[model samples]
Target: MRGLSWQIGLRYSMDRSGNQLVSFLSRLSMLGLILGVALLVVVLSVMNGFDQEMRSRILSLVPHITFQPWQQDRGDWQTLKAEVEQHPSVTAAAPFLQGNVMLIKGNAVEPSLLLGIDAAAERKVSRVGDFVDLGLLEGNREGLVLGDALAKKLGVEVGENISLGIPQSSDSNDVRFAKLPVLATVATGTELDQQLLLSSLETAARLLPSGQTLSLRVSIDDVFNAPRVAWELASVHGQDYIIRDWSQQFGNMYHAIQMSRKLVVIMLLAVVAVAIFNVVSTLVMVVNDKSADIAILRSQGASQGDILRIFLVYGAVIAGVGALAGGVLGVLLALGIGDIVAAIENALDMKLLQSDVYPINYLPSALRWGDIASVCGTAYVMSLVATLYPAWRASRMPPAEALRHG
Candidate 1:
């Protein structure tokens, strides 16, 4: 069997014109495979990276589940949190006070979303403490943790004091304003970095004349299970509160990434298709150049099927070689591009990962095995299909007439 295979390979290689045509076709195939694989790897990696970054920045700070009452602006958060915790999917639940408030520091003023959370409870649900440095609550109900951008805008440092004022009551003429001490600085490269504030729930409750908590934050066992868990929680809680998922708030960006990924796939497929066509053309040329040999084989009682198989195997070799080369090259390029770009950016003193300009920094690449397999498989299949017609045409040649003419 091994000797037979070697004989077939030797015959295939000895056909000079056939080998040249196949080599040319193989080069074109390699070009297509290289581009397609490289693009697929790079794009999917980028999308995966972006998706991960978004999840980390958004989910790390925001709860997987948020409970906001439908009819009432405020609710008994402690009771609701306790009730929600009974569910197996529910991991930790915390009370939160959320409202729009203004911060005044060193003659500069900025508007922000005031999130009042119990320090201990927040630790259970989110990573606020890790992001926040230089904060000491110590039961100081009037302390605040400010976003890094907001702090810079207000020209306030970690130890600096800032004035936080709630809107005065409409009916009463008292000019009392809620002022707080700035305790910490948080710098997460997100929208929250510019317009989010952290304070004690007690302080928030006191600031509001109504003295009510608006929402309760819940963290689930798995983040991807947020919607399912939220649905179950809502089913249990009844119509009093509405469930909100991170997707609902940020679906546009996710959808955009998905659309871009699809477009990339289409583009890469076009390149592969072009490569297949090149292979088909190369096979046709090979069949023409090997017509004399084909005639001899036909006279030797070789079946048409055998002739087709030989040519098919020849095309397969070319396609397989190119696919292998492309796959290896693509992976190497994808894995190293991020580090290469980062290094260049650093040497040039240019911020490739700009926090102030963009939401996140650092080029991210995440290659999936599925994408690689799909690209390589598609190339091989296309190349084989493309070989059929030309090989079949060569196989059907008249052996007697060709031998007499030659």
Candidate 2:
């Protein structure tokens, strides 16, 4: 280290450019790094937030698995339930009636899916009890819970009577409707906000005017594995009934969330990569300006490999510093984005993001360690690679040629 002092000092001094042009380039490199990392972090965090929101909103409303009868009133109800309950994965089971019905209130008609569920047993599988506010389902057989958005659309409220009209199946064409009393309203964000309603299985079946057959609604301990478990249940029970997992029930929404996340990631990465190219160009210019010093070192026993490594190490250091700073900035921005947007919106006296219009009301973020680590590591690695060609060319310059040019 002592013997190499002069060379190290020379190299350090040569790095200090005497012009504002070089200063501007240095600032630009840092700026590019900052922008790249900040955007990457915030984008990934927002995607994570959206993904988490999807699961919370969707999973809370529906059961993990539904054992549907192949046809209405088609199978042995009690025996199938007993066989399905025997599976280790199945924690709770209850019979249900699923049918489409029309809601009629004083001449206004709206189509709605009528779900028949056992009041007491449905609680184990669905969050119907939490959704109920006024009338107890046990006391009233015709009681129903409407989604808040749906209720708004239909102009119905708690304790109001809404006639549920189930279309007659036979071609005989007798007009009949099942009139049910509204019990409560449920609020769950998403399209489910507008369509879903809850009612007793007895009421649902009665509304259908169809004979009751036990179509089981099952809840398993592991929700992510619901599809596999549902298939297992079907396999074990000989597939007499149609078994559906939550994934199948909400396939389109699930795929849309995944695609959105991927698209966001891709776009962010493309932006970051372009910014990183600025860092590459800046390092290349620095190498070009130091060619004479590099040649002198080559003459004084510094191997080509050592010169290459020294510049590579310097680039790595710069990248590491930039990445660390950018990551900190990103996390801070994400964590405070809600407050920041809220302040902006309040000052303007307008809503920036309305939940009714957008899925969420504010800028949501989730700063995950995995995403941060991946971004930082990738930036550092790219910076290191960016140094290679420039550093190699600097080290390979002939001493006679470099000194004459200088």
Candidate 3:
């Protein structure tokens, strides 16, 4: 009986060779399902890729947590660092000093951030030296390394003297100046690249009284737990210590990415829902067109259950073909998205994202089988639901009434 029902369902689905609207609607149903699933796969993978780039490329430059003394007196940084490193979440810790200084070249001058770091220790927490133009991060003691943007603005390069204007005393309004040779430049590809200058702690100490201010910057195993880890740092360091995390500076951007992901998913789900429900109209029309065939079958000893099974088989086959094609195509698109985006960018002669403004210079994509499974499951379920009402209607038709009415 099931084999007979399948034969009839397959024939009905394929018998739309003459009618234009039936053929058109059938094609439209498949097209909608294909496009909907493909879109979800491509878009969500891009979002996941962006989230990954933000964490690995951008966050690698900043400390996840910082421990500073509220009072100006410096704590025993070596001991404190040792203690902080014991935490399972903590990856590396380094001491740093930050000060505002002005860089003056031959004719241009700019305000810059003087970041004092211990090269050996800083290497553990930051990727500053990894992406330099020349072999610049050799850390010539008492020398300076400027960010690419900062160096360009000042019209200086390696082996140039840039005068640093530093305040002489906190007691009075005296300003002292020191001439430092630019050693190397770094490009972080971030806004931080505009005004950042890396100097050894020796240089910063020589320029400014060092013992008064030094902070411990720590990196963590997980970016999301930075704030909680920071709180733990504070609690362990006692009330006199102050704590800050990268989330305090970059949390809003991370939050915006997450919110956009959710919003995009919700909006696309609506689109897929519309496409899936379009199956209802197509199936209903099929039922109407085949009512006579259904009557003939009923009169020939086929039960209502048989009639119902026939249409159900028809609907399932339609959904399965559409979904299978969509799933395959979507995964293919997701896998090739990076190359696809690059081609589009080259053809348009414009970039989708600017590295300095956005976290990455290009769109990224990662296809996870789990996400594909979720999309396929949802599409299949929606298509099945859409088939139910029309299938049920076809089963309830009275054979004599349908034949007489026709």
Instruction: Highest TM-score: give the candidate number.
Output: 3
The digit string of per-residue lDDT tens for model 3 on 103-190 reads 8898888887788888888878977667763234335466888878778888898898889888766787777799989888777666
Candidate 3 — which residues are off by over 4 angstroms? 102-111, 133-135, 139-143, 146-196, 207-212, 404-406
Please report, as a residue range, the 10-residue window in candidate 1 with the lowest summed lDDT.
Answer: 1-10
> What ranges in model 2 sit over 4 Å off?
1-17, 54-57, 74-76, 105-109, 128-135, 170-173, 178-181, 236-239, 290-310, 336-364, 398-406
**Candidate order, TM-score descending:** 3, 2, 1
lDDT by residue (tens digit), candidate 2, 14-45: 45554456557756776778778888888888
In the order shown, the candidates' Cα RMSDs to the true structure are: 4.3, 4.0, 3.1
- Candidate 1 residue runs with Cα over 4 Å from true position: 1-25, 53-57, 69-74, 103-110, 133-135, 141-143, 148-157, 160-184, 189-191, 202-210, 235-243, 292-303, 344-359, 398-406
Ranking under lDDT, best-scoring first?
Answer: 3, 2, 1
Instruction: Tell me how far the alpha carbon of residue 370 in candidate 1 is from the true structure, in angstroms, after superposition.
Output: 3.2
What lDDT score is found at residue 31 in candidate 3?
A: 86
Q: lDDT of each structure?
A: 0.73, 0.74, 0.82
